[model samples]
Target: MPMKGLIWFRTDLRLDDNPALLDAIDKCDEVAGIYIFSENQWNDHNESNVKLSFLIKNLEILEKSLSNLNIPLITLNTNSFKSLPKDLNNFSVTNNINQVFWNNEFGINESKRDDLSAQILNNSNIHVSRFDDQVIYEPGILRTGQGKPFSVFTPFKRRWIENFDMNFLEIRKPSALKKSISLNNESSKIQYSKIHKVDIDLWPAGEDAAAARLSNFLELKSRDYNQSRNSPILDGTSRISPYLALGILSPRRCILEGMKLNNFELTSGNKGICKWIDEIVWREFYRNIMHSFPKVSLNKPFQDYTDSIKWRHCDNELKAFYEGRTGFPIVDAGIRQMLTEGWMHNRLRMVVAMFFTKNMLHDWRLGEEFFMKNLIDGDFSSNNGGWQWSASTGTDAAPYFRIFNPITQSQNFDPNGDFIKKFIPELKDVSLKNIHQPKQDLFSSSDYPAPMLDLKTSRLRAIEAFKTAREFNNS
Candidate 1:
């Protein structure tokens, strides 16, 4: 009998550069794949339907790709993580698998589920192997001179550069199986309400599409990335984020491809290419943060003092913010874009998040959940890190006093209001000078609402709230 192996697919979906999948193929004569859909767990995590739909589409494409390699994908459905161990163990027994392999995922609940599953498999006399494929540096590998995880990004990045190895970017290509195996398991059906579905067609599914997008960006737009990335109106970004979030493309592949364009120099390269690489590193940094500080994965603030901060609750304002009727053109536009397309530009993400936590005095967790509930590119670590940073509640966060002024940010980034007008049609007729902060007359003539609150006063209020929380904590 051939040595049988099972590959458990999680966030690392693509076959290319997949260490766990490649390892399984190398070790066993015949390999099968399994993907378990934990609906209850996803609901508990506030996963967006848009993200779910994208994931299902990608899974279909991945299944087809795996089939070409003579690997059959077995889909399973379970309500939550608590049931995964039993399901996986039963599947392994029924399939008569000798070994199981998977890539590691970082999250408190995810880690727990994997640990239990590994224990169960070990007890069943089946070997389990986990690979670090999500990040270039395994979570605990990179540390400070003091033998601690670096809390700040600059020093962490410096060490990351210092410790950089060309071997880390090596891409793995799995060889085709010698013979095909028949599996009786059926693919799990995914159904979502019509209201929850977004037009995911905007993002084509598959590894080829992802690779094409990366190639196009590097060849055409990377030179201008640093210069125009902040402008929402311009196609200045790689737009490969959805692929990255879904694991249709790997970070190592992204870095390696980008470095090729920059003469294989990560630090001294085309400024735009280098900056884009920095952004990828930032993503890894957030993953490290989640691994080092698991409390963040559990909805706890990184800065303990932030827990004492009293957040205001206003249903009307919250609804307005959600519906893109907050009367702040830039913030509203960003929110509207996210609602419509299930994605938001990076710069706008920060601006709107800061507006929600500071100007609106809402809890950062609320904004974080809202983003996760809508964004197609929603990754827990990145979303949580961005939110906590905007709210000044995480390690290396912006100081509480550094609140962003929405109107000014709008003028600076979306200067001519092109991005604002694209999402908020009412502002199309408004003059460029008045579009960022439309006058009362313009609002009355058009359907646009006026500024919800005086900017200066709101900034002062948010500052006072932070100060009060810090003072109380000290007392």
Candidate 2:
């Protein structure tokens, strides 16, 4: 009898550089692909409808790609992770599958599900193999001199570079099966009540589209990325984040292509190329943080002192912030962009996050959940890390005193107010000087509200709050 293997697809959706998929293809005479849709799991995670739609669209594309390789993609629908193990085991038994392979996921719930699935498969006399394909360096591999996981990113990145191997980025393309296998057609339709307002045309699904976007960005805009990425008006940064978040594109492929542009130099090369690679490393760092510190995944702040900070509960303020009615032009613009596009610029994300956590004195988790509910590129680790960093509650977070002045940030990053004007048409006639900090007369005339809170006053309030929390925690 031929060895039948199943490749369970999760976030690692792409064909190229997929270690588990390649291994399955090499080890088994026949290979089948499976994707389980857990609506309960997605809702529990506060996943966006836009992201769900994107996933379904990409699965359709991936199905065709797998078909070409003579491997059938069987879609399974499960209400929650609790039933997934049994569903997987039953499928394996019914299909006479001898082995199962999958790429690992780092979330607390996801880790538990995989562990249970492994046990179920093993008890059923099936071999289960998992690969760490998400991060170049698997979690727990890099540690500080004290033999502890580095909580800070700088040293983590430094050690990451020191332990970097070019072979890690090598592409692994799967060969086609000698004989075609057929399975019952399974629809990948995902129906959710809440649909996002984002234009689907802006983000097309598929690996080819992702690869093309990466190539275009590298060929045209990568060289200027360092200088231009901070400016929200220019399309300097690679907008392949949604693809990356969905695993339509692999990080290995991204790093490999980026390295080719810089002659395979990870650190010493074009400043722009190195900076881009740094962002990739930042993503990996967040993943490692998720793996090392599971509390962050469980909605606990990394800095224990932050848990004592009294976060304000103002529904009106949060509503205004969410609806882009916040008086701060940059914060309002960023929220509006996210509402309409299902994505926001990286700089704007920091600005808005800081304004929420520092200026509004809201809990970082609130902003984190809001972003996850709306962002197409949302990943738990990155979103949580970013929010906690802005709130000074995470590992290597921004200093509590380093509150961003929204007006100053607006003037610096969006100098001409082009980005703000683009999103907020009511401010189109406002002058550049007043755009960042509108005068009372202009603010009223343009129908834009006055500054929500006094910036300096709010800054002091946040600082005092953090100080009190720290002192209390220490005492």
Give the winner by lDDT.
2
Report model 2's TM-score to 2 decimal places: 0.98
TM-score of each: 0.98, 0.98
The clash number for model 1 is: 0
RMSD of each: 1.3, 1.3
Candidate 1's TM-score: 0.98
> How high is the lDDT of residue 443 in model 2?
30
Model 2 C-alpha lDDT per residue in residues 1-475, reported as the tens digit of each score:
8889999999988898889889999999898999988887899999999999899899999999998888888888887998999988988888889999999999999999999999999999999999988789889789999999989999999999999998888786788999765444454555456677899789989999999999999999988899999999996899998998988998888899999999999888798989998999899999999999999999999998899999998999988898998888999999999999999999999999999999999998999999999999999999999999999999999999998889889989999999999999989988887888777884365678777788888999999999999999999
